[model samples]
Target: MPVRGGDLHVGVWEPEGGGPAPPTVLAVHGITASHVGWAELARQLPGVRIVAPDLRGRGRSRDLPAPYGMPTHADDVAAVLDHLGAGPVVVVGHSMGGFVSLVLADRHPDTVSSLVLVDGGMPLLPPPGVAPDEMAGLVLGPAAERLQMTFPSRAAYRDFWREHPALGPGWTDLTTAYVDYDLVGAEPELRPATRVAALGEDIRELVDGDSVQHALDHLRRPATWLVAPRGLMDEVPPLYPDAARDLWTVRYPAVRMVPVEDVNHYTVIMLAEGAAQVRPHVVEALGEAR
Candidate 1:
């Protein structure tokens, strides 16, 4: 789809039996992830249309120029909805996409009817003693580190993720397709498509910038936050810790909190079990949207 800078790559999945206009879900992926990450969610909601986009600096849209931040990403998403003539659709965002979704609804209210925030969309203060600039690296860790590494082959990249503590154990064909789609360039020099600069900008915004905070304060749409108990590496203290989750609950009681047990940050969307947990929320949000 044509946006401000260039063409944005959007992956659209129609339900099994086509209808004139299926209920639509706009899925936004994580910081270093592509639209393909939503494969399981798309499959689970076979009756609804899934329209997912590779945000400007990741996936097939990697070359879309920077100025990368949640607001910019929000506008790009708004442009996508405008191009498709799709609006007031259910928006499901995972990780950084959740931040983007917040700003999208805040800035382009007409385009988003409701939100399904999978392990994201809330404010994350920098851990004590960690500088704002260092928070992304410390939190994102391996997911951000791989962008600087090069792989000899697609298989090599798959091997890298296969050994990942969180993603590896729950690996599936759906996850494999997502991993493959993130690779760009020729053999021996192939690298992840996410731009390091874009990652930095987005992380700063989500963790420190005021846009997300403002969005959270002004959020008017019905939203649901699906919490993952484990962190990015399948460790304790997930991204939205219980204390923070509690704080936000008090602030925005309108946004329902749904706990998804036994899944890490990655599995919440990549694996079947996780998608099963998320499917109902998407359906419910769509119902609310209508």
Candidate 2:
């Protein structure tokens, strides 16, 4: 779909044996991920239409140029909703996409009726003296490293993920497809379908920009934040550690936080078990919107 900047790539999924038009949900993927990341979650919502976009500079939209940030991403998503005539839809965002959803609701309230933030949205303040690039490295870790490296073939790419501490054991066909779709370029030089420059700009804005903080401050819609117990590397302490979760719960009392068990940052929405946990919250949010 053509938006203000460029043609955006979107993935739409509807229930099998489709019936009357069901409620739509605008699902957004993480910074490095594409619309395919929402595949598992979409399957869980059997009767709903799930519209997910390859946010500019990621996935098939990788050719979309710079000037990327949360606000620009919000506009792109709004354009998609408008083009589809999807009004007041429930917005679901995972990881950095969660931050974008908050901006979407704030920028175009009429297009969003509620928000579901999965493992993101809350401010992740860097420790003193942490630069933007360093922050990106710290948060993204191997994901950032993979973007700069090349794979010999799709199988090689799969092997790379097969060794990832977080995704190795949790691997499934759906997850495999999601990771395989991320590979681009010719064989022996295949790289992830993510623009390093655009990713850097997005991370800079997300970590340094005050827009997300401001948006959450005045959020009017009902929002639920689902937190994974493990971090990006499948470590013991998750991104939102106990102390951090406690602080956020008290600070942003309106945004209810629910802890999802037995999942890391990546699997929270990309696996069947995690999707089962998230399904009810999405249903409840859609119900509230109705």
Of the candidates shown, which would achieve the greatest TM-score relative to the real structure? Answer: 1
For model 2, residues 152-199, the per-residue Cα lDDT tens digits are 999999999999888889889997899899988999999999999888
Task: Name the regions of candidate 1 deviating beyond 4 angstroms.
Answer: none
Question: How big is the RMSD of model 2?
Answer: 1.4
Clashes of each: 0, 0
Off by over 4 Å in 2: 127-133
Error of 2 at 229 (Å): 0.6
Relative to the true structure, candidate 1 has a C-alpha RMSD (angstroms) of 1.1
Clashing pairs in 2: none
Q: 169-212 in candidate 1: lDDT tens per residue?
A: 87888888988998999999999999999988788887756889
**lDDT to native, each model:** 0.90, 0.89
Model 1 reaches what TM-score against the true structure? Answer: 0.97
Which pairs in model 1 have colliding backbones?
A: none
